[model samples]
Target: MASAPPAGQGQQGAAAAASPLAPSEMYRNYNFLLRLDSTEVRFTECLGLGMRIEPIRYRESGVGNVVRALPGPVAYAEVVLRYGLATTPDLWNWLKRTAEGAVVRRNVTISQLDNDGATPRINWNLYGAWPCQWSGVPFDALGREAAIEELRLAFDRLDRA
Candidate 1:
């Protein structure tokens, strides 16, 4: 009653022809990640030294409201790395009422910047830092890779004593 895949028709050659793009052309395909700058910063701060680095996943909004079911004017965030240690104590709690709840925004203030470079100095200002209670404080520094590298290096050196 049902027909076969058309013999070798659905085999190697048939599948190959069905493909839209060539293998070599894969690299040519457009991916947003391709545009990510090496200079762009990625930062993450654990509530405590015991907190290990993990991928941050959350429901938030940014820029336009094209997507739905996410936070309005939500921020997926910009800083992109994990912090195992800290130069200063994290005041994530008490700073905002939504610190544990999912109803707040991560407040980040990019106070400093480098007109020509990606990595810049940053300051994480917590406590009333943002409106809806909790918020991830952003960079507030100005410099090139110099300051950024310094901070990153410092974070790596955070050891429990």
Candidate 2:
């Protein structure tokens, strides 16, 4: 025959089961910032921050029905940043220089902040990034929307910190 648990010990297990588990620290996507060469830039949207590795498949003559894949060159995707039109002409000037045949490469960093919105939890560093494309906001007199400019950047390498 098994003995029963102590008077308070049985209630302790029940209390723990009734209580909900504490959630881990999770960051919000909206709480992030973008920087270009140490200059903080305010952007409403950022996309295409990723990389891909191409795999090269190989087959040996003696191996039967077996194929091996080898890692190939890595490609970094272009990042697109969108911001509302402002009086500042820094972004415009960068695109203008690229259009004039002078490619000005800059380092870009995107950081994900914690709940405080000030402390950086993760950072993605893009090296040798340059303006590849720029689009002006569409003029919509009927629509009540703020003008937003889009800038596309091509980077040679990407690192995460």
For every candidate, C-alpha RMSD to the true structure in Å = 17.8, 5.6
Tens-digit lDDT track of model 2 for 22-103 = 2336678898899999899999999999999999999989996899999999998889999999999999999999999999
Q: Name the TM-score of candidate 1.
A: 0.19
Question: How much does candidate 2 score in TM-score?
Answer: 0.83
Off by over 4 Å in 2: 1-24
- Compared with the true structure, the alpha-carbon lDDT of candidate 2 equals 0.90
Q: Top model by TM-score, which number?
A: 2
In candidate 1, where is summed lDDT lowest over 10 consecutive residues? 28-37
Model 2 pairs in collision: none
Error of 2 at 140 (Å): 1.5
